[model samples]
Target: MDFIPEALNKKPEVLLIYTQRMIRGRTFEMIENLGILTLAAQLNANGFEAKAYTGITTDAVKTIKNMKDRLFAVCFYCDFDNQSAVAAIISYLKKHYHFYVVLGGPQTLHMTEKDLGSFQADGILKGEGEETLLTWLNAKIRGEAVLVPGEIQPAQNADYIYLEDFSKYALPRNEDVLDYHERPLLSVITARGCPYRCAFCFEGGNSKNLRMRTAKDVLDEIEARLKRSQRPRYLFFCDDTFTTNPVRLRKILSGVKRLREKYDFVWFCEGHPGFLVKHLEFIREMIDSGMVRMQIGMESGVDDVLKAYGKQASPEDIKKVVEICYAAGLPQLTGNYIIGGAFETAETLATTTRKALELLDLAPGMLDLSTTFIMPLPGTQIYNQPEKFGIVLEDRECLTNLEDFPVNHTKELSLPEVCMGRSRFITAVSNKMKEQYEHGLITKERIQADFKLAFNYGIAAGYLKFIYGKNNLMVEYYKKLIDYQGLLKEWHELSEQEKNTWVIQRIPDFSLFDINTLSQLEIDILAGAGSDTIGETAEKLSLSAEKIGVLLKGLSDRYFVLFSPFI
Candidate 1:
């Protein structure tokens, strides 16, 4: 450890700020920011006073003023959505404070040296912030700064700051890092870096070396968090590929299974498509181990487009993997799709939409389609050499809007054109939703309920499953229909004639559920539910209020009925 002057302080002090451009107006749970917490953990283990806060949740300058300890540096973790907002905060802090200001995160990984000046921060560390950040901080304190005074540089192997023993730094003291007052989910990154090389991914070019923590270590962290009264009902594995290594994933999940028997929580994780096809059988073990949701990187469903993106699977294989998972009792599957690939064209777009729509037909509420236009971040292969990927950077600064940028990941179609194509795709999906509604898949009450709430039913389903068991079929039912934003907009466009209470009876398709499995009273409840609320059914059928409420709730849980607005 290096010596510091007594005038500065007895110990080096630093402040980590996790600032976001969004989340100010929205109701959200406080999340455990793993990136900043890990760095804070490293600082604390070595003798440094570190504090952190979200700029949106609390004021940055006020945090500085209220701190009892003096500070040497202030670091801001940036999200891609809030790049401009974070930059503004950095400039304001620089004007108001004397400490060194630095920015690091996913957004920084995409910026080059020329772009660093635009941020206006004192220094920007251009890679993973662990070892590089510590060395940069320690050297600055020792008056032997790594770069020429106030100069920003890219991270290189010669920095000699990598954490060789990753296990020591993997866990952080939650109190020192984040507040989990209302947040019921804890994000755990069991590993760092991705192995596959997908051209459009930032991890492909930036995060090179993959490091992992053992299964025992992960279970220990969960137990510790549980003891702290921050009982997380869900665990989101925030790794680039949580299911990359078969052996490691098995051990980790086995431990997770044991923990779930006591604490009771399900989890969500993202994986490469190749991995899913390779371990088709193991998916059951994943589901049985309390994995409710699986997100696959299915950027494009067309085989040709997938090939161009360097993804390993074909269109058939993509379809095959999802079919396998759904067959193995996986309740929900989310496939990510991008409209404007480097090789995107009208034909390929049609095929991709058709593929997604077909899967939606097969899985109904069990499948979620996450569709969007591709963002060409600076360090990506597409951004570095635009012509090579059929992209045109009309104005790189206009990144906040998809339509205003003028280029949409490909020179073949302008950004607005891409937006229009995405709009049409959404309209098509909305039509599919209407089709499902017409097919007796859902009750009129659910349709009325969704339209009223702007269709935000997916989030509630997960929490509902905690109260109702994972086996409850209704909680696994309809996600806020695919393209919910577009669906909301479509509702706004609807004339009074199109909007509801203009009800055609959403008579339950009795063939969909097994009547034999239901009891005589439960069967009578469904028969009485037509065009009538549960209250009305109870009165007309002369059923007791308690019997009606219990039976109705049970039916709703089993997917035989919906008790949305009408009831």
Candidate 2:
């Protein structure tokens, strides 16, 4: 997203806000504003100061107000989930704060002139922004004509700029702006762009060009990430297709193997089935390089659906990739499956579900999956030309829905039918994945590792919902929610006065129940909670332990209080 003005103050500091949209019940999977962090690192390298914040627009407005006049231009990584909030933030900041507002991210790749005006942002940066943002801002700082990266002409209509040499900027992941000591989003972007244009992927707008950082640079980053932390770290390769280039991949694996000898860490990456199959020899090397897990884009197990979606891999490739990873002794291999896509039929959906379960059965403990309803995000092939994919869009507004539901239906499947099919598919897969633990397939150590990983930065991963189903780490927590031997203590952050006067209605949403509010009794119980076990606290309150045990469990789940047996 980009249009830069040729005038601005040279006061070095910039603010990049990643506006979050909350859907009452569900939270985002992302623990941090990764894109904003990448841009912040870029600015730091260019002799400018920047900080990244992820919050609702209201919280963002307060952050800007706190900065007062230091903010000459505030940038945002605007996205589909919160467009209205971003637009409102831009309009208000421009009106009252009186600073230049720049927007970028997935939404900008598809925004038009009218959309830009409505957003009230000075410019929308399209495609990659690491280089463009710096170029545009630097030119404005020097009072030179602002332009796109590598372009001789002034920036015009929606532009797509790739950082040509991805190594031109700093490591895309930055920990300076992040205070997270445990999980600093140890994600690395060894490369950018995908060569394949899958019909539903936003990468289609990325211009189908692949640019890679040098192997030494990527290796240096992995070592840098592992150097300071003593605990086991999980690094995620954020590249869409980490296995795209085989020779480079081999070098990466070799570097990671060397690093593992000195650092306690494991890593995961998104893999392309087609590439993995072609370079099948690398699977063992990847696992040997501390690669414990892999995420695959097995959109469907039906070849017809895969073909219609323009995915390069066939169902055979998906099966082969899973078997290769599992047989190579890869501990875990999870793939993504689309339930309600353009060409989905009952038979195709069943094929995906049945075959997916069969794959899991084949590997038993090693294979798993996540299923999502197909939503045509803007700029994707289906969004641009639904007719081409034989999809009919019905509820356009559902595009921003945090919960997955069918928004479009094919000629063969009605909206309701698609919805039902998706529900069935998810239920079946989630159940099978659960058995990975219940039947002693997936281990408690892994589930615990994943659990800690989800909240490493103090926010739940979207997969928290699934964590409960796997039912491993929580067993002890549940057993001790009111364990008479354990004590109940308020989260240190809650003030004494808050406990004294706050009513049940005054409490904010709980992790357990944004839907269920605290009852008056629950409030009293919270106020009285302390180092004393609930059995003792109940006696003090003249209430039965069971009466308030469940309530305290809810409060404890939200971290309102730490009901021991948990950290």
lDDT of 2 at 225: 63
lDDT per residue (tens digit) for residues 1-567 in model 1 = 222344266667788887654445332225567778778878877777776566563455567666523667788887565677677776776676667777777766556566566787767776566666777788877778466322355452122123445665646656665342434466788877767667777676556577777777877887776667444366778786788788888998898899888885677788677777878877888988988777887888677777766787777777777888767766667777887776777776788789888877765445656566666665667667667766666655545653222345565676677777787777776677557644656433433333322222223332122322233233233332223333321222334433332111122477556789989887776676546654566667788766765665556544565333332
What C-alpha lDDT, on a 0 to 100 scale, does residue 426 get in candidate 2?
Answer: 78
Q: Which ten residues in a row have the lowest lDDT in candidate 2?
A: 500-509
Model 2: colliding residue pairs: 1-124, 1-125, 1-126, 2-124, 2-125, 3-123, 436-442
The Cα RMSD in angstroms, rounded to one decimal, for candidate 2 relative to the true structure is 11.1
lDDT (10s digit) by residue, model 2, range 1-567: 222232233546688887666632233324455688788888888877777776766667788898746665688886666777888778877777655677887767666667767787766777678877887777766657665643322234655555576655676444555344555446677776677888888775445577777789899877876776666677778877688878888889998898889976778888888888888898888888877778888888888778988888898888888888767777678788877786778888888889888888777556657777766777778887887877888865464455466778887899889889878887887788666646667543344434444433232322344645344325343333324222433333234443332222112223433334657776666555444555555666777645655665566444354544221
lDDT of 2 at 78: 67
